[model samples]
Target: MILCSSTPHSSPETQPSGLYSWPNVFHVPKFTYEAEFELQQRNIEFETNGTYFNPGPKLKGNLLDGLAQEMMKYTNYPKDYQCEEVAAALTRAHPCLGQLGSKTGFWGWKQSLKYKMQNYRTKLRRLGHPEIRVNSLKHKREGQGKAAANIKKARKAEVNYIPLHPKGETIESLENERIALLSEVKKRDNEVLIKAKMENTFYLRRLEIVEQRPMIGEFKNRWPALFEESEVNAEFLRITTKPLQSKFMSQFDQFSDKLIHILKKKGGVKGQRIKNVLAIKDLCDDIDTRRECILKSVAIYLNEDPDSFFKEYLASATEDAERDISSTVMGIYIIRIDRNREPEDVGVVIEGLKVLKNVGSIILGFIMLFGLIYALDLSFPENFKYTFKFCQKIVMNLDGHKLNTKIQQLKIKLFA
Candidate 1:
């Protein structure tokens, strides 16, 4: 009668698209097959304790059924079948078995499953849907297209007993194991610790995005900011995104540090020793394409957002009148108000007009056209095309050269 559940909780991970990852959020080590085997071994070591799982029948992968057979290996399941009491014990023992080995910790699989289900239900209720239970695979699409809405309503009106979902249990166990392994590795690996902490940081930002715009309009406005931030959030991204440049940098630093350490230990390495060091140095140089990548990124980012930021130095302040945003500002404007697109895209306006009266570009003609297009889209004061062309008529002495396909592609993809 004892029904054990084998659900363990998992930690959350932030997805790239800014979704919250709510995983199986708990741990239960004792319900695993290994834990049962250990418990059986422990009972024999204690001499007086009754036998544990595996003597009577083999497991069928179902934790509850397995626990039933495990109990009956030496004891009678019918006699021992007290679901509630046994479930409570499994709940208490599962965590300990995970921390200390199963032999010292002790829990039955059947009871563990039930306890896990109870814990899962408790968590789901905490998430605000008390009536909504984990959906079992067999029952997932159930009652959807059925003409039994009234029956479903009646079931809801009465006390309904929802079956525990096997997948949910599996998810929970997997989560617990993954987080436990991560925690164990963290003690020995700096990289794992860095990744774990970075994951938390990323999740916090994702939650912030959810708060700002759960709706489409808000998301459209806010998504750009998230995209921009993701570029520089952590070192792994920085190094990889910057590509072979960072790899070479790391290799160089490591080799230099090693060489210095070796030299300090012994004054100098000559002949064969020098050759070994040179080989390492050459290996280090092989990963050095990072500088070229850095130059390209610098050219692009600094060109587009000239006043924003650079890896070398803090970006020049927008207030610095002498700063050159001619290319960047024009690029922003062209993108936002090209071919009768809205002048009312306030982000583009702010970015374009950030420097106000100082746009010195060969494409200043394009800027005039851009403002006119925005005006036409907004029905502002005048016809933008006519006004700009008329102004061109008076000043530049040019007949007709407007933003065409080649210009559009260039302006949007790369800052001219």
Candidate 2:
């Protein structure tokens, strides 16, 4: 069924059913939607084997065997039938033309037929069929052969030059001092802050590259099959079409439903009142999966990476909140804990809850706890407002004190 240039030739013992190699007949590659529509408007009839071709009678072998064998008769113009007329006749005889749901589907069918017909033509041309004109000048195009020869001669005549160094100094030795300095620079450039200072040009270029990264590029890289474009007609068919299929659009709908459910949930309050906190943690884990799926759906819809979409949303929301809004709804509490804190450290505290034995459950428990705090802030604005303000001041003073202590310690070290 699938036809390509790489397809192997059929063996003599297992030859294809009625595959004929005819001469002076070309396959129609651009027989597209417009051609089909024009043919339909003309309403032409197809004649095969001295009678009208019918799709009703099932062909013994392949569905297109009759068309491929008889197509040359119409194309050769024995009765002076024009190309359009031949196309109309061929379209009328096509088994699946009517079954095609849209113009694109019809065009795709025509393209497939065209490839099959081309393969047949190529097979015949290989057997020295005189009437079929194979392009003998493929490797000898006008001025190309002579230009290639000239390039080859130039390459043969060209000389290699090596830079001369002193007898004691080899190329590597000569560059050793510079290489050492370059290695040091490279080492310094490994960290982000140092790289920004040491390699300003490259750091700025990196920022620009990140900023200009296309949403479509991300989708294509992540889901290549879904976003892949046909090499032949990519401009018209793939690039021009948006929301490529119902499946893609359905993802957006599912995501919207998830967001709506999140907004409408009263389960958070009920789960909070439960004697067991593990039950609430399990629910949050499921909700997290739904949230992740929603993000993926949005990423596909916008033709962007999920990370980029999240970053852009956060940036825009922050901008809007700063520009128009006077206050923030969400409060962030930053607690300085051991940088090397392990899961086992939290496991002891959650042992009483009895629900978070595993590392995953413990992580989910923390997520639920934060989510509960956020939900309560929305529900009880009066209570959390003053509490958050006090916490904010406390954090500010703690940071200032920490900085002052560090400065005092540095002064003592320097003076001593």
Candidate 3:
């Protein structure tokens, strides 16, 4: 008689449908369920060339019971099985599988192995054995986390990775250094352009002032308010006087004195323009009374309306000045007066000063002050007061008696 162990390696075809083939020899073990599981974990072939797991002879009787007894020596008492731990233990049992890591076919053999373990757990429940489930929920969550990590990596890869510069790009060069260098270059270029423009403007303004200098000097000589006295003298002293074209400096030397006499005769206190005026005996009283009288007459001459004049002149001058400023300056940057504030505006102040210098009338000065205070509603009353006070001091510094007589005579001539 022969004895053979039954294991997963044993099958009817492989065993030849009879008793064990090893009758006189030591019996070989048959294939068992545990050995089959072990083979799957090791990814080894169970059958090859129409043979069982063991291609040699069939095993002896009841190999499954013997293998179970042998396995009990190293097996844990509880025997809780998780997918990876069981895979690791099986690989430990058979070192040949360790090099291959755990081989599954195409789609991940671990998933299929997990289903098998679930079924095994179900069987244990049916057998009235308490369930020994290993915690694989955390491992599943980690797998999902890995999938999410891959998705994030793919998203990051979708961004444009080409370098802006000619050289090969690093992360710092592509992201930070490129922008910083380009921006610095652009800013430096803009600054250079602005500096060039400012230098050009400065030279242009200097040229204009130099060209207009001769003409402006003549105006300053005739119109004292147009320039400071020291500036006028300094400019005029540098100018070389031209020689007389005629063959006589003596001829024109007395010409000015003679002309002054002739002008004095035609235009004097006794002229027809001042025929209604009388000389003042008391200088102080006449100055006080005549100042008021002259102002009233001048107001009548202006039609007693200064607002219209201020508005008309201010608007025109402001418009012209603003246009000139806008045309000369480039870009959005500018220096300008706010014309909406009317006479309080600096443009209006410029026009006023020019008009005052040309008018040369003390009465007109008062009128302008009134218009600025009342019509234009300039809020600076104290400034106006101080300005008029200064003018009054200047007037008081003059020969009051002579000035009073001349003003009275001039008013009568102008109004008559």
**TM-scores for all predictions:** 0.21, 0.18, 0.15
Off by over 4 Å in 3: 1-397, 403-416
Q: How close is candidate 1 to the true structure, as a TM-score?
A: 0.21
Alpha carbon deviation, residue 34, candidate 3 (Å):
99
Candidate that scores best on TM-score: 1
Residue-by-residue lDDT tens digits, candidate 1, 15-125: 111011111121222445664666556545545543233422333244454333333221121222334344344534433222223342333544455554445434544
Which candidate model has the greater TM-score, 1 or 2? 1
In Å, residue 22's CA in model 3 sits off its true spot by 99
Could you give the C-alpha RMSD of every candidate to the true structure, in order shown?
A: 24.3, 27.3, 45.9
lDDT of 2 by residue, 200-244 (tens): 222122222222333333422322222111211121111112112
Candidate lDDT scores, in order, read 0.30, 0.29, 0.28
Ranking of all candidate structures by their lDDT, best first: 1, 2, 3
lDDT for position 369 in model 2: 26
